[model samples]
Target chain A: MSTWSMALRQSDYYWTLYRRTWKGSVFSSFLTPLLYVLAMGVLLGGFVEADPSRLEGAPSYLAFVAPGLLAAQTMQTAVFETTYPVLSATKWQRVYFGMNATPLRALDIANAALGFVLLRLVLIAIVFVAVLAPFGVFVSVPAAIGALLVSILVGAAIGMPVYAYAVGVPNESSFSLIFRLGVIPQFLFSGAFFPISNLSPALEWLARLTPLYQGVDLTRMLSLGTWHTGPALVHLAYLLVLLVVFHRVAVRRLAKRLAF
Target chain B: MISARGLRKSFQQKGQEPFEAVRGIDVEVRRGEAFGFLGPNGAGKSSTMRMIAAVSPVSGGSLRILGLDPATDGSQIRGRIGVCPQEDSLDTELTVAENLYVYGRYFGIGRAEVRRRAAAQLEFVQLTERGGAKVEDLSGGMKRRLTIARSMINDPEMVLLDEPTTGLDPQARHVLWDRLFRLKQQGVTLVITTHYMDEAEQLCDRLVVMDKGLIVAEGSPASLIAEYSTREVAEVRFGIGENESSAGAVESAVGRRAERVEVLPDRLLIYAADGEAAVAAVHDAGLQPVATLVRRSSLEDVFLRLTGRTLVD
Candidate 1:
């Protein structure tokens, strides 16, 4: 088989295992988006005043935060998928070693794992979009599709680096630190909850430097049908570049770590 | 099927001197033979096995598997051989059958073919009934059988088993051995590494005894015994620490019949062509012993004679 097909076949292992647990994941994949749309958008959004100018032409707070929540959720999913699971496969369960004993190389294992993560990101994006669609959160069909694609890109950008880190860490103790200092901070301060312009100027600049903020901004613009060509390209470029660089780095790290 | 010359492996941790695991050992395993590497822990057996399995890189020296250089064609080499590592690398989350199916898929086997082989292998390992059970739910022996079953999922030409029965009970080991013996009968080349001498005797056609990262002796089981040890051994125990002081008497008592007397803290092992005659000589010399027994010599004696230490220790 070609290397690409071999990698795809390797990913089927994860797919087989995932089939046993996807039912239990309904809480995060389906209900989390529904809860966020209802509790945060419908209920909490009523208390906040909608300012189309400041909200970048969004009709209401619900429309504004829906895509941002989707982007944040994607980041969270990507981080969750990459951290403990990658470590467990590399160390505890040694699934990668088992595959390496076969015709699959380290590159194939990395590609297989990353491909599985991307498959999950796409499924979660679909659920998030479908869940919020009836609430009229998106302005157009193209906007919904655009936000979905951008969310998956954002997930890849965040997840690939986390995978590299996961492969290098000696144990799970560092995972809590990553969640506390890295993932949690990005979730709270990366323009997912409010406009970065609303934060202090320094904090806003720092937030803009984060990949999630770029995703959130692009997703929100796409959802509200207010994105411009130049700024959208810039955000897409940042996310695309981050995704490619970290993906290559993750593949290299897996190869190095599995080289024992 | 496998060849190596001056094969070496070293590990270099940061800020520490490099530690050589396999120190320049030459080995050859022909096709259709059950070969073994017999050694204690840290004897470089696993390291050598990894190189042959095409997983670990050779630190230095030349090695080849199925005539392919691992440095350039590792995946190709791996495609033709199966490896059961010392540690259990089986996926705990997967079911028994699922593990086989997934591992077969890694070899790029078609889904239908994987399913067919998975069932056949499960039956081969006598785990057909446990196919749907989670891997963690099985006992250690069952898990090991499942691992062996998964190793055969790709229908590999050769199988490398590192300590295949290390933690198994005697019955479990026997069951596993029966399965492995069946594989050998089917013409699959088997290369095993083990600390247990009986396992080597039971399964291997020929073996190399390793110690301190070096091959100390190499031959068939009986040949090595003939070369390094006598036909039999007489064990005489004078009770506890008394055996140490009684070594001189025991050695002098048996005389020429006792080719050598290995004194331990609790007993004296008198090597002889006739173990009962050696024990009778000890009695005739009026050296009173608490207990006595005679048995044929084995690979253990050969290793002890070569390394001057026990294999398991």
Candidate 2:
């Protein structure tokens, strides 16, 4: 088999597995984001005034937070998918070993897993957009589509590194530490809830450096029609670099764990 | 077919010396024959099997499977061979049939072909009735059977089984052995690794006895037994500490007939051509044991004679 064919064949294992258990994740992947929009945007927005300048060109608090949450949702999906499921395949269920025993190489397994995560992120982004369309969160159909694509890119950028880290983790005890130290902080401070400028100078610089923040900013700009070419390219380049570098690391580490 | 010369595998641990799992062993497996690696746990059987399976890189020396170098052509070799690892790495999320289907797909088989082969394999393993059941719902034996069936889904020319029937009841083991026997009869090359001497004798046409990362002896079971052990073994059990003290007396009692006497924790095994005569002589020497039994020598005796340790522990 060709490399792409082998990868698709291996990913078909994940696709078959996901078909049986995808319903169980609907609450977390879909409902949790919608609830965040409801609680943080609509109910909480009523108490705050609509300040477009401070909200980074958004018309209301709901408009400001919803698009950023879309980006954050992508990050969350990517993070959640990469951590436990990656570990389960490598260590618990040993499905990666099973795949490695076949014609599929270790790189094929890694690519297929990351590809599945990307697919899930895209699906979740599309559904999140469709679910929030009536709320007028998206300013234009083309911009919304652009935001969706950027969300997936941002997810893969974050997910790939986590995939690299997860393959070598000894057990599940370390996953909570990733969420507590890495994911939760990124979600809270990465321009999702508010602009990073609200923080102190040092923390602002730190937030600006995070891929999640870049993703949030890019996703917000695209959704609200405030995108700037130079800054957009910078954000896109940052995410692309992280994605490429970590994809190499993840594939190598996966080979070490499964093929050795 | 598989061939190796000075094959070695070692694992490097942090802040520690590297542990050598396979210490320069040579092996050759012919096509359409059942070959076995018999050893206790940590004897490097699985490591060697992994090398043959092409999932693990050779730490040193030369190795080849299906006439292709594993380092470069692992995917090609894996495509033509099947592996049932020691652990049942079956997909718990998919149904029994779906597990087979997914594994077959990993070989790049088309969906219709995979479905057809999956049905045939499930039927072969006598799991046709439970095709739609969740894998977790199956018993251990059934799970192993499913794993074996999954291995055969691609119609591989060679199948590698690592401890194929460990942790199974007698009836379950017999059923698995019967299935493997059928596979052997079908002219598929079989490579099996097992600690069970009976399993080795029952299924393997030729086997190597491995211990402490080296192959100590290799031959057909009967030939190895004839070369390394006597025809019969007289087992005499005494109360705990009494067995060790009685070894000398038992050996002397059997005289020239006893080739060797192995004193285990709870019993004394006297290797002799005539076990009944050996047992009678033990009684004649006024050494009475709690239990006395005479049985034909087996591969277990050959292992005990070679390693000074039992095969299972």
Candidate 3:
């Protein structure tokens, strides 16, 4: 069989597995951002002033936080979705054993899993953007589209490494560590909800090193049309480097784990 | 055909010893033949099977399946081999039909063809009605049948079944055996590992008995029986108390009439060419046993004689 067909088949397999097992989680992913928009944007925005300094020249707190939330939520969903499930397919559930026993190769399974995660990110981003647009958070149609694409790239950039980590280990504790030390730190330091200028220089440097920060910055640039070429290029470069590096690591780890 | 020369595998445990799971062993399985490995647990049957399935790398050996080396051409070799693992590895998230459909796709089968085979295989396993129901809802036997059917979705050239009927009920086992027999008739090479003597006798044309990662004997069931045991076996169960000495009585009773005498915990087995004459000799010797049964010698006796222990032990 052709490589594309094999990859597509694996993609469909994961999609079906995800739909059956994680449909509720998908709905829950959309609900998290919706609640944030309601509780932080509308409820808190009612009392707080719409300061341009706080929002970095966006029209409202809702507008600024909306794009960042979209990007952050996509990263969150994609990272969690890919990590445990991919690990389970290898070690716990052993679904990969059955798949590898067939004509499908390790690269096919990895590509399928990443492709499925991207599809889910697209769906979740659409719902998130649609929900936020009516609240005066639609900066521009092109910017919104750019935000969606950036979300997928950023999520993949963060997630693919976690995927590599997941396939490399044989237990669930490694995933927990990734979430606690890897993902949680990214959430706190990546400037997803707050400005990086407020943090210490040490933390600022560390935040800039993460894919989540690059993603949040990219989304901010796209949504607000406030382009800073140096930082923009740096963020894009960080994400691109992560994609290539982690994708190669993931392929190698999967070949070792599944191909045996 | 599948061939392995000096196949060896070892696992390194953390802060402990490195255990050799499969010692250097050679094997050759011709096409359209049923090959079996009969051994107790921890005897490396599963490990050897895993290497042959191309899902486990050999630590040192030359291994080939369907004329392709598993190390260099694993994907090509695995593309045409179906494997049913010792453990049930079906996807519990999807329905029985979806399980087969997804597996077929893993073999790079087209969507239309996957759907068609999923339907037919489900029917073949008598699980058409449960196709839509989730795998977690199905009975153990039903799930096993689904696993068997799922392995055949690609119509593989060779199928490797590791203890396929390990935990099934008798009726379920019979049904599975029938299905496997039909697959054999269709010219598919089968490589199986089982400790069940009856299962090995019923399914395998030739087999190798393995113990501690080494082959103890290799031959047809009937030939092994003929070589290892007499034509008939007489079983005598004594009603004597636990502390009573029945061994002395049993030895004196059929000691001269039978070719060999085995003293088990619960019963005494007498190996003889004619079981009727052995029983008469035991009665004439004035040993009144509680129960006496005469049956044809089987592969179970051959295995016990060769390994000097029970298959389960």
Candidate 4:
């Protein structure tokens, strides 16, 4: 078998396992994220989101904020997929050690794990987009698909670096920091609830530097059917570089930890 | 199928002196032969096993598994060998059969083929009826047996079992031994390590006795016992605190009757070809305060004779 095939075989273990365990979290993935979108975008948007100064020329506040929530939810799903489960695979349950005992190299196992994480990202992003579709969140179907794809890239760009860090310092205490300090702040400040225009110049610059803000920028353009090719390309390039560099880091760290 | 020359492994912890787990030990495991490492804890038996399995890098010396250099061809060598680590590292998330099938896929086995081997291995380990059971539901012995079955999923040519029966009951140990013996009969090489001399004697065709990062002795179980220990031993135990306090008197009384004598905390062992005569000589010397039993020598005796200590601390 080819190396990719070998990696896929390694990932097959997770797929089979997830099939048996996914039921417990099915509602959280769809209903919970959807509820957050409806409550924050529809119910809360009617009173304050109608102000034109902050809506960024979008038709409605729900349209303006729906794409940002999609990006934030993607980031949450990505970090969730990479940290605790990956640590268990290496340090606790020792599934990665079990796999390394076979013909698979540490690189193959890392790649397989990354592949499984991305698959989960795709499934979750699709559900998030589906929840927003009934409320006229999309100007065009293809553009909505483009936003979903870009949001996945955004999740991965952030997820890979977090995964790299998690594999090395494998303790439960660090996870609270990721969620409280890292994820929740980005979800709130990085144009998810309001445009960067609403933030002061310093905070907007800081938000632009992070992955979720770039994701929101590119996805907002796609959702409104207003393609700003120049800025969109920058967002795309920023995300691609983040994914590549962080993926390399994650692989190196995991290999160092797993192999002698 | 496995050879090593002056193999060594040393770990360097920050702010501490480097600890040498295996200090330049040499070993050779022939095809279909049961080779054993009998040693106490911290004697580097598991470190040596990791080096042979290609999971750990060698700090010094040359090593080859199936004629492949682990430095360059670790994955290639790992593909053909199986390791049952000292800890039961079975995946508890999957069912017993699912664990077998999933582990087989790590060897790049096809789905249908892995399924077939998983079923066969379950039967081989006598867990066929519990295939659908979750791994956590099985008893400790069953979990151990399932681990053994997982190791065989790749149908490896050589299998390394580190302390395969350390915490197991006698019946569980015997059952696992039966499965291992069947593997040997099918022409599969087995490498095992344990402190249990009886286990070494029963499982090893040839073995090495290691202590404090060195191989103190190496031979077939019978030859090592014959070379290092007497044919029989007279074990005498005194009442209460008398065993330790009466060491000098017992040594002088029965010392010359036997070839060698060892004083332990609880008992005094007099080694000789004729143990009954040694006991009678002890009685004639007016040292008749306790109980005595004479038994044939075992690897435990050889270990005690060579190392000047009992096998079980």
The numbered model that scores best in lDDT is: 2
Displacement of residue A180 (Cα, Å) in model 1 is: 0.9
Query: For residues B195-261, could you state the per-residue lDDT of candidate 1 as single tens digits?
Result: 9999999999999999888999999998999999999999899977898899998888888987999
Chain A TM-score of candidate 4 vs. true chain A? 0.95
Ranked by TM-score, top first: 2, 1, 4, 3
- Deviation from native of the Cα of residue B190 in model 3, angstroms: 1.6
A19-97 per-residue lDDT for model 3 (tens digits): 7656676677667778989987778766657567766667776776777788788888788877887877886668877
Off by over 4 Å in 1: none
Q: Per-residue lDDT of A1-260 in model 1, one digit per residue for the tens?
A: 56688788876688887898898987778989999999989999999896787776778888888988999999999999999999889889999889888989877888888888998999999999999999998988998999899899989888988898898788999899989988899898887777778899999899999989999989988888888989889999998888888877887788777777
Identify the candidate with maximal TM-score.
2
Fnat of each prediction, in sequence? 0.89, 0.92, 0.75, 0.72
Per-residue lDDT of model 4, residues A114-156, tens digit only: 8888988998889889888888989989978998998898888
In model 2, what lDDT does residue B234 have?
A: 92
TM-score of 3: 0.92
- Interface root-mean-square deviation, each candidate: 0.9, 1.1, 1.7, 1.3
Worst 10 residues of 3 chain A by lDDT: A21-30
Better candidate by DockQ, 3 or 4: 4
Q: Given candidate 4, what's the lDDT at residue A9? A: 79
TM-score of candidate 2 relative to the true fold: 0.98
DockQ of 3: 0.61
Tell me the deviation in Å of residue A153 in model 2: 1.3
lDDT of 3 at A50: 53
What is the TM-score of chain A, computed separately for every candidate? 0.96, 0.96, 0.92, 0.95
The lDDT of each candidate is 0.90, 0.91, 0.83, 0.86
